[model samples]
Target: MKKNKMSFETSFWTGLAEGNPFREVDAFFAFAYLDYYKQNLSEMVIYSRKTKVYKQDNPSDVFVLYTAFNFFLKVCYGLQKKSKKWKVKDSLCCETVFHLTSLTQEEYENPFIVFQKAFGENTLEEFELFLCQIVELSLSPHAGDPDAELTTPYIHLIKMLDAGELIRERGVEKIRKTDQMDPVA
Candidate 1:
């Protein structure tokens, strides 16, 4: 994934200034996923910095990010419920960053609906690959789902990462500064 010439915020500002926040989340998700996740980063510090201070205050934007991220997770891994209490987990926030870059929703929910089916019976690592695949597919010009057919790859790459994956490489030291806090159920 190559870095886009412009940040998602560039396009977002124009749309937001015009009162169109519909596809911002979708575009942001695409942009961030490509730049931050797919391509290797400089020590992962760049993305790490972008994350810690970021917050999603808008309900609509929250809905979009969570819906998309959760959809991706579901598609790749399997159907799972999300904890209502938010945490600073990279697995969660990485996807959220994708949504934060832009604003707006696609009119049809076919992509999301199609992915929901593919999510069944997948392991976490396998789900990661599926996620990579989904981003690749979505970026392609020929990509789209009218009927939203769900197909199975039958590949299992879901290596459930421990705290290491949750914290991210950059946050490793930061974790030592804090104590474990029970997650809100």
Candidate 2:
């Protein structure tokens, strides 16, 4: 999907500074799902980076990005559970996500600071979207596979996020210098 003029950090803080992180996520979803993105698959999305021709970014990319950050909410929820720093409350609208809250604002935007302190900034990004998909596929019909409404992928995802701590314990730039990750794909 196309990036917005507003950086994610800005949009994230606008809502989060008010104690409702979900509002930020929903704002992104709203901005990305605008009418322009609702065009036919063949329609031009934006100018290509290397050429004048318009870019036909798949509409599905928005969904992928949405799912990715949506999963982030859960990750924060799970992390907060153990750290007990944010004092979060459950989301009544959708149990899958928890709206993380914080009273103080540090110069740096590190809601996951507790984990970061213990594990380095490895969790600055998501664990692995590809690996998660493969594992879920191999296991087949996991918790929320139309059942575990079933299951909480967020908690499951947190389990993997914790692995970053283990990886950082060994001390490296990141997990395998492994980047280009995240999402339900």
Cα lDDT of model 1 by residue, 27-88, tens digit: 33443453333132221212222322112233243223333433334322321211112222
lDDT of each: 0.30, 0.32
**Candidate 1 accuracy as TM-score:** 0.20
TM-score of 2: 0.23
**TM-score per candidate, in order?**
0.20, 0.23
The clash numbers for all candidates, in the given order, read 21, 2
- Model 2 misplaced regions, further than 4 Å: 1-58, 61-85, 88-155, 158-185
* Segments of candidate 1 deviating more than 4 angstroms: 1-67, 70-120, 142-150, 153-185
What's the lDDT of the predicted structure labeled candidate 1?
A: 0.30
Top of the candidates by TM-score: 2
Give the per-residue lDDT digits (tens) of candidate 2, residues 49-163. Answer: 1133222234444444435444444333444434333322322343222222211132012334444442343343333342243233323322223322202333333333333
